[model samples]
Target: MELIIAAGIIGLALGAIGAVIALRTAKSGTIREADNKVKSAHAEAEQVVSEARRTAETLKKEALLEAKEEIIKNRQAAEADDKQRKIEIHNLENRVMQREESLDRRNDALDKREHQLSSQQGNLDRRSRELEDLYQRQTAELERISDLTREDAHKELLDTVRSEVTHEAAAIIRESEQQVRAESQKTAQEIISLAIQRCASDHTAEITVTSVHIPSDDLKGRIIGREGRNIRTFEQVSGVNLVIDDTPETVVLSSFDPVRRETARVALENLIADGRIHPARIEEMYQKAASLVEQRVQEAGEQAAFDCGIHELHPELVKTLGALRYRTSFGQNVLRHSIEVAELCAIMAEELKVDARLAKRAGLLHDLGKAIDHEIEGPHAVIGADLARRHGERPVIVHAIEAHHGDIEPNTVLDVLVQAADAISASRPGARRESAENYIKRLEKLEKIANGHEGVERTYAMQAGREVHVMVQPDKISDAASTVLAHDIARQIEEEMEYPGQVRVVVIRESRATDIAK
Candidate 1:
């Protein structure tokens, strides 16, 4: 039994060993399968990772391109904005510069005005000091020299000044009418009145436009030929406007210059009278008209001088004097005015014991400059004076002519007499028509100019702006100051005014003391 049992145990151990080997083989197969699966998964994961890397690279490139494009666009926009800002800044700078320049000009003007005011103030102060010193000396001398009190001397001085001024002014008037009142009161006026009545002239004033009467309106078409050439040629030759319109039986001639108007009128009238209207014919007629007008002017000039009982004037001067016939001053015929003034001057010179013949000659030639004033510049008086001097006139007559309007100071009685006669002629009631607004403005300006001075208390413009009366505060203005003030005012008026006549500036300084018996 022991042999059999040992054999069975050996068989059992063999079986056990076999079973262990089988188990090991199955576990090895499972591990191999797991390894193969894990390797395949690793390969798949590698492929996925490679594709993802390619996609990431492509995306990165696209993003980089977009970012670059964005950077470029931002840069361009920033550059454009910078350029616009620069332009605006430049414009603002220019505007600022212009404003600064304007302010600088204004400042310069202000500085100049201040300088002028300061200079005037300095002159006024110096004058005041000098006047004060003179007054002190005069007061001391008066007190030492006279037994009369200051009030008595002051009254006597005022009386003496009044009497002297009145006497000198009245005596200068040469009241011939007053002197001849007993025998022939109208003798002095009769001379001028008779001259006016003797010399009969057409009172019709020449107009800028003159009417040309034609035979019929059909003639207008001939006057204005094909393409308006005839009219153009006529105007070119005549130097005037020819108006061809619906007006019946007439044509019009227009020009601003009176002499030109007169010439054109005569030219047109001759063309009408001849009835041969063409450019060549118009030219011929115009020349003839000019010659005719010149002859007429010469006749008128010679007759004017002869009628005034004056002779020996320059031939050119006589012609110019004759030209005044076409000139009108304030609706009074300049030629007529001149003749009247000459006659009046002759009478006044006879009364004043002056050169009557010289006075009449000067008066006739006084307005000679007016003939050519339209062609020249400057005052008529100054121009006439120059003409007279150029034509070898006497120095006294030349001076009298120049000083007739107070352009120069009157140095002789003849000068004064001429001035008076000119004033009388120019200032007749209907001689001039001053616009009311102009008159008021002139009066206001005269007052304003006088009031511009220091120490003036009140200012009055009187005698239709011929005189300025300034009343100064006695305490502020001295006797010498009054005189200087008058002179200054007169000078300022002359510098600024366009008045036809001289202005008399009178400054009054009154000092009155009163003791009431209350």
Candidate 2:
């Protein structure tokens, strides 16, 4: 029985062991199932995460493609905008070019129209001239038809016409004068007034230096100098005539050369002033005075150039110009006259709208011949012209100088203006002096001279000696004959009288025969 109990205990132990193993196996199976579920859950979570990541990637790719499409659209819009802008710019340029071409065409048309108008105006002016000539002829014919003396009819017609025309002419003149008065008066009156007022200096007389007066008779004795040695030396050296006459306190120094005369004057003045009037003193003073006079002459020439606004004169030319101070023409101081003429020329040039400086220069040189005429033996204008040409004066100015005295035909308008201005200056009132007796005698002589002409019926010297008006018979004096008569009168005047300036002779060839047709 004890063996059977041990066997049951063993069997029970075995059975317990089997049961423990079975429980352990069951716990192991539970653990394994829990691990599989956990693995499945992790796998599912991983799959969901991978799916979300793929979806996000797809959405981002779509957004990027849309952005790329938008960029392409903007780029296309920009290209289109550029193309349109180019087209607009090209159209604007074409429009501007078309407008410019139109303007050019319009300007060309205006110029053509203006030219046509000018041509038409010129034709109208020519027609007006012809009409005026026809009217004048018709009036003359009407006068001839009247049954009265031609002169009476002409006079009556003239009186009636003058009454009507005078008022019209006066109105026209007033209108025209209103427009041009300031300018015309400025030119004429202002210049004339300036010339008159400025040149109002009393005419001065110039004389040949024939005499040099001394302070006392004692000076004469001293100038004669210790048995006539000083006087002889002075006469020999200076080539002047010295007369220690009985006239109290005076000696005479005479020389043909004004330069020599001036030299002698200075020498004598020095000798007298120094109270050393001997032959030796005379020689010393003569030398010094000669030097001084030369210096003064050169200075005078330079001064003249300076005063006249002229420069660059050759030194030799200046010396010659200065020599004019000692010269005179027709009792007028030549240098003074030159200065006056220069001023007058400037005024005239300004008035007439000419070159003032050139005019003045020509005027200054106009009478330059007078300075050397004694030596040159030619007309003053010709000599002056030659001298000016030699001294490198402009050809025009030289021509003007030669033509001033009518030595040559005036080639330029300026030359004629100069001649006229010269005449005016010399012929102005109080410019030249003559006694009343001489004036009357001159008139009578002129009348006689004109009457001596073949056709001259009467003669009158008007505007002083400037104009000589002569009445000639129309039968004897043709237009050509009148010119010849004028020339002859001028020649006679030149031959008979010692006139200061030019004289004009005008021959009037007119016939007055009154016949009453009635």
TM-score against truth, every candidate: 0.49, 0.53
| Candidate 2 deviant stretches above 4 angstroms | 1-194, 198-203, 433-441, 450-518
Residue lDDT tens for model 2, 387-494: 989889999999999999889999886797678667766766656566689888887888889998776788889877668999988886666556556766888899
lDDT of each: 0.78, 0.78
* Candidate 2 overall lDDT versus native: 0.78
Q: Mark the regions of model 1 whose C-alpha exceeds 4 Å error after superposition.
A: 1-204, 207-221, 243-252, 433-518
Q: Mind giving the per-residue lDDT tens digits that candidate 1 earns over 9-45?
A: 4555555555445555667657566566555555655
Give the CA lDDT, 0 to 100, for residue 413 in model 2. Answer: 67
On a 0 to 1 TM-score scale, where does candidate 2 land against the true structure?
0.53
